[model samples]
Target: MEYVSVPTDIPDEQTPLLEVYDQIGPKSTFTQTTVNSLNLLMGMGLLSLPFAFYKLGWVLGLSLLVFFCMLACYTAYLIGKCMEFETGVGKLSSFYDIAYMAYGAPGKYFMVVLFSLELLAAAVAMLILFADSLISLVPVLTPFKPQIMIGSILLLTPLTWQKSMSKISWVSFVGVLSLIVLTVAILWDGITSPVGPGSIFDPQQTNMWPEDINQIGLGIGLLFVGLDGDQILNLGHAVFPSLYLDMIEKKRFGKSVSITYTIVAMFYSLIGACGYLMFGNEIQPEVSQNLPLVPSFNVLLNQSALSFIAINPLTKYALIVHPVNSTIEGLFNIYSDTLTILSRTFLSFLVLLIAIIFPSFYKVMGFIGAALSFMTVVIMPTACYIRLSWDSVSWWSRFAHSCIIVFGFGFMTFGTYGVMTV
Candidate 1:
């Protein structure tokens, strides 16, 4: 979608550090770009919650939040580098081309491989999850399970198959809202429930190490690694236009990226901490799958008329939220069993489908590990942007940052290899 040119009344100092492109290409119908990217990423980050709880318990979950913070800081820095080098056109190859513009052919090729591979893996993984959800919903449809999986590839192809980032942004927004409602309900039950224990940190417990650090390490690796692919790439896709706005322009790209990172990281950390605390070590495999088992909604959705309302939290929340923004907190107390069955059915289908395709849990871990590690930890910041920004920073500071990024890449590579071998 073509971006409308910013009004020219702004001061000379207000223009972006980088030259602003009047149009961000063909305009899209998607309105909620920021919201979509935020929720999808939070979903991926929270996907690790159950495993984190199982392996390390709540304490380690909190510790992992610290790691997420570090990762977010790094992400923001890379994004600023991306923005600083942005050439106004927000195409899929924007970052790769920007790196090329600043550095050369080597830099461009590296980014393309890194980003494209990572995004492909991410899109496939999400589609896998989507198919898995469907199969669990209708067992008799089992014969067509493979068809359903392939069907999703076809279904998503149009939605995301089109090159329009704006439309993708909107779809992402709907997906994100569905996720947010589920998250809110889960957290509400968590906090107000009888078992509520407010503090996330307890200083008295000293033995921070778990009995099996390998599983713990692997779980930790998966938590951050799954976050790459679609969500971050989408961020690169949508955020560039907004970053060119006056407020963001004067602050420099770093502050905007920093704010975005901190907000998103804190959100995931809170939800992960809350979910683990509420569910204890028995955290669900993925948040969406566990929605069916959520007790409050289960009881409320028992009736027939309200049954259809529970198909998936995505639809449920949107229908209610669309007409009246205030309806969410108003009617959350009402539950319908049909809604329960529907959500659970969806959850069951997804789990079974994923199990079939990725028969071994290790495959999920391995694929996610390699793809995310390459994109987030190794390729984008370290290899591509770093090459472009090599002279962008002072020599000593640049060298130190490069060393740290390299260390992160090495650890991620080691973890990916470990997942494959194990």
Candidate 2:
């Protein structure tokens, strides 16, 4: 259960920016850190929010989005506290570090297992998105989505071999550009053509409230999946500690994080509202699928947007699976080219199979948010905070943390069931 630290052969110039910043003393200003967080994590869940709005309707959907954002923000603060608890063994680097500090080896195992699952789930969701985009772009690429998913995996495998994080940093730009183009295209169409076959602005096309109150549980899960795009700031529990530790002033994490979450929530709410108004009950899981791909400016935007989606995940497959690969290599005390290739191949194929099976971006994301994220974002933070700061943590804070844990379980349970059933 001991966390491994496997050194790579990447040259000094290729070291990760965060590591370099840590070595040189954190120079990241609050604005810079917040912007970095926004750039890296904002869009993972953004595309799905419109359909999330469809599920819970406008009111409840937006409420859950904001609420989940708040939860992610506060838990992030909890993570900072966990790091502050101090094990007298220098700085803690990841969720595994915090877990091991609070509860020993068992905790480290839990973190590794859960984090690995979450990463694969995230990668799977991305694969589904990338494949779906290909099908959307080229209707004749063997209309079967599974085939596209496999083809995309095989094509991206070579790029995934690059061990240096710098080689893939450009992936961030792909995500941000794609988000801007998609958002602009969606909002532009929503404003310019508010009434037409592809345009919608009627009560029948949208609702302030969901027709079934019972869906509120399922709605929470779905919206959490989408809102998680920002609230976790896409760092996930595994990577967040490093970002937090790299801050110029760790004390300022709350402020920078709060501002980042607010920006993400507002943008998500706006796009969710606009997409619903445009496509109403017909919005696809990715939202881009509903864009008016007519012969116009929008079509050009669609091409750019789809191209980005297709390429974005291809870049991430290696990054997400790297941690898992490292953990296994470090745990076994063996590292070689053969091991790296086999591990990456096994992980990629595993996720590809999962994507081919579930296939629905919405459902897969919902399960991730409901099951994995609820645990990492909600349960783990509070648990770690209480364990690490039980004495110094305020009495009210302790009670609040406990209450949030119970609530998280309900959300995870019901939310997961809802995804499976709905």
Per TM-score, the best of the predicted structures is 2
| lDDT (CA) per prediction | 0.46, 0.73
Residue pair clashes in candidate 2: 230-233
The runs of at least 3 residues in candidate 1 whose Cα sits more than 4 Å from the true structure, single-residue gaps closed, are: 1-17, 20-43, 56-60, 81-93, 134-170, 195-208, 226-250, 294-366, 377-379, 384-386, 389-395
TM-score for each of the candidates: 0.64, 0.87
Cα lDDT tens digits for candidate 1, 1-422: 23455655643644553344433333332223333334434534355554554555556756765665566556545655555554434322355455576567876666555544444344444444544455444446646756765554333322222222443344344445445565655555554445323222311122244546666545555566534423423434223434333222323545544555566667766666665555554455554444444444433322211122123322222221121211221334323545433443343344336545564333464456544654554445555556666766788867776776776676566657655554
- Candidate 2 error regions (>4 Å): 1-23, 197-204, 212-218, 227-234, 292-297
Top candidate on lDDT is: 2
Model 2 compared with the native: what TM-score? 0.87
Error of 1 at 243 (Å): 3.2
